[model samples]
Target: MVYVNNVGQAIMQVDRWTTLAPGQARNSVRIESYAVFNKGLFILDVEAAPWGCGVWPAWWTVGPNWPWGGEIDILEGVHDNVHNAMTFHTQPGCSLPTPNPKTSLGPNSTGWIESTDCNAFANSNSGCQTVDTSQASYGTQFNVLKGGVFAMMWADDGIRIWFFHRAAIPEDLQENAPQPNNWGTPVAFLHNTLCPTSKIFYDHQMIFDITFCGDWAGTSYISSGCPGTCSQRVMTPSNFANASWTINSLQVYRSPQISGASLALPRPRSLMYLSAGLILLLLYI
Candidate 1:
């Protein structure tokens, strides 16, 4: 079920995330209960507004240790008309080789630059690829003008992602409903491995949030002409102006047939009745 936290503003925000100052790292947000991620699948579905130049907004995941555990950046970028980068931050030992198909914009369009020189994974390195916005700019692409769905799925083997034009998101998964079969396996992996710590992999609470300007989207690209104050180039006053990213909701689901139990269960009361009858028979005998 989807739970909306109505505390801060009528606007949507998950209680699981702590809002930080503009310069805070994405890893800095503390989570109180991530235990729910044990063995099931987690999905994040967001509908966002477009922000202007230098304003970076993202929906990502990170683990305890820096690169040892891993990090998954599902959706991240600055300008509305630019790109939506999907990246993996892993330990030196683990090689995150981009498949032969490498980068793809839509199913037909493909091409992306891979960088191992700069540490995009570390606070020092920032790596990304731009998605063409000629068809529909980020602002118009997501808002009421013409929005779309950006999804990430997490599972055991690997990670995969797919972007759907507003018209494409299947009707069932549209409003944050947990529709596993329709999501497919590859997509599920990308969403799950965002921050793959063996213990916390599938058992942590996933979060969806928006910050004005933080380290990666805000500062890392400042030298490349991120517009803002010279001292803190990532922070742009115009960022909060016409900028906003909206999430209709987020939903999670476990495999339908994981432990041999039927996916279709009638009701809790029915199960209770069967247990009560078994208890009475045992006592009588």
Candidate 2:
């Protein structure tokens, strides 16, 4: 179910208080943006993200036509993960550099390249993933810090993702003028000579989902050391007490060279709740 909290944060959550029958999927929320973006800056200020076993949550963007239009996973995790994985899902011929240069990581970034291939068909749809090594980057620890900001830049050069702790968010970002270049090295950088951004990614819409015991989460359920099987856990409603998203705001800014929308105006209301969590307050700038 979805609603605004007493603090005015947009909340999308699972049916944690309801018990379900076998083979039944938990009721949740999945909302997408009405407006599509070609290349722009996306900022998500999160107060809390879903956690716990059998839970898979993501704040991402994807184009039409599946793999061809490409997918960028800015914030995604499954189960009891302590770190975040930034990924790109696309067709073959898209890849990041192996033995990535040290400069790829900003001085403050605590992440590393996990895979170079962007092929969704390869390695079981692993895609090209850069993983944040910091324990606070995801899950339980992230909630302890009360969440923070995730800024992504999708541009001609490539895509870059940066995470800042609540206490360390950049002043310019908080002031409404985000200068990504000055923000230093991103935790994950998807640029490479082999992958042309223009060919791989196109008009895409933002997506936020909180799924239970799906492919990504179920496949790794046992390995995560969570008690019982994924399906069994799904029947236990209380297991998802923490499986919800409390969002402060979501804002998008087009490049100065490409102008269309004004700065910080609410987009048209077109919320699609299929199966997971969504951001209720989204602004276009």
Candidate 3:
């Protein structure tokens, strides 16, 4: 279910009123950028995000070949999480240093470090993670603030993520001159000192997806305090009324020195929208 609103915003939504069979998966949307990028500043202005039980929503970037090429999870969380989790998935050897100089634990950021090892095979593929402490960073609280901008700066040195509430957006960003240095304390930072981003991350495409009862969500469904099982929730049609993404815009600004593909706004015809009306059910298996 993908449609454009009267104001030109894209509304990628999940099926909210369809009762499914015992083994059926609910329909949802997962869209990706038309072009792959090497390095740039990407900003996503979101009006609403999918929330509630049995849903996992994320806005992230991924290189080729699973974890070998690296994956950067800029905005991600499952179920009724209040804070967004920023994570990095890479091959073994790339790790976030303890007492990281660029995380919330560091003097330069505001997100608390969750895991330091970025290896996709370690800790149930948890990756290196940092969690935003702000109550308005994810889920229902975020929508109450009418959403905001999630800015990601990917450079040769490192990657940094910042979330600005609708009322506190930086003036420079509004003026189209994004000076990340002037923005104080990012919510998440992955430096290159220990994690060789150049080798681990490359040719990444941006992604937005809403999946239900998958690995992350299904595995922790009971613990999330949702009623009944995750599969049972899928059969209940009313569990997904708010499971949608109302995106105002996604803007990408590339540096002349970055030596990557030219960044262009997604034209309506060029955008690839995928809405699986009959997706395979994925449980804790």
Candidate 4:
């Protein structure tokens, strides 16, 4: 839906009012951006999110192929859970290093990593992931607080994600100037130097989807012990009243001018220097 809210900003949502009966199946909503991006920054402000049994809503990015390409799940969860998780999916040869004792985290650095292997083909496709420690970061609690802003800074240095409460949105963002360096420690930080992003990851298209009774949500729906089959809970209407999303917009920012030289320049002491040295050595011999 499209309408102007009291705040006078345009809004779009996937607020389904009804539900399917037992054995009924409905294709969930999925919005994928056509543009492909590699290195950039993104900030998405959501007014509400889908949070209920058997509902798997996520805002993420994925490449064309499966494990060979890559995927970055910025937000994902199953059932009526409140905690939020971030995951990185790739092929083999990509793994994360455990944080050392010397590493210090700020107040916002409360994320707990579940797995260190980013390879989707490995670990049963669990991927390298981390969960947010903030209660007001997702699901029921997040809506109760009137939703919030999620910022992702993707660079060769590392991939970092930050959460800012609706009320805590920085003035800089409001003014359209986002300075991530000034922001506090991210809720999720995956160091990519070891994985070498270019090697395991590739161009991706943005995606926002809410699927029901599939892999993550369906297979694990019973883990919450909801007292029924995954499809049973999913088909019930009352179970999905809260399964929706009220989104403002997604903003992707990148450098206006390309950095570095467009063409490669020869080194000061390149192959020519080596050739000259080899000739001199042969003369001495």
What does candidate 4 score on TM?
Answer: 0.81
Model 2 lDDT at residue 173 = 72
Cα RMSD for candidates in order: 10.9, 5.4, 6.3, 14.4
lDDT of 1 by residue, 147-197 (tens): 565544454543445456567766655544434446442221222223333
Model 4 RMSD in Å is: 14.4
* 1-285 per-residue lDDT for model 4 (tens digits): 334466544333344555776687764567666567775677777778888777888989888897766888898888877888888998887766664345423223557766778888777899988788777677898999988889777776567788888999987766656667567678876666567776566788777777787888888877786668887776566677777767665567765221212211222111111121222222121
Once fitted onto the true fold, the runs of candidate 1 whose alpha carbons sit more than 4 angstroms away are: 1-40, 98-123, 127-140, 144-146, 175-205, 212-214, 219-239, 256-285
Tens-place lDDT digits, model 2, residues 1-285? 788777768888889988989988778888888778887778888889999999999999999989989999999999989899999999888987674475444233447777889999999999988888778889998988999999887777778788998999988878766666567778877774568888899989888889888889999999999999999999988899999888887767764452212222123122222211234544211
Q: Any residue pairs clashing in model 3, and if so which? A: none
Misplaced by over 4 Å in model 3 are 99-104, 258-285
List residue ranges in candidate 4 displaced over 4 A: 1-21, 99-109, 256-285
Q: How many clashes (backbone N, Cα, C below 3 Å) per candidate?
A: 22, 4, 0, 0
Q: Rank the candidates by TM-score, best first.
A: 2, 3, 4, 1
Instruction: Report the C-alpha displacement of residue 20, candidate 3, in angstroms.
Output: 0.8
For residues 207-272, could you state the per-residue lDDT of candidate 3 as single tens digits? 889999888999999999999999999887799988898887666776544321222222221322
Provide the lDDT at 96 for model 2: 72
Model 3 residue 247 distance off true place after TM-score fit, in angstroms: 0.6
| Number of the predicted model whose lDDT against the real structure is largest | 2
Per-candidate local distance difference test: 0.41, 0.80, 0.79, 0.69
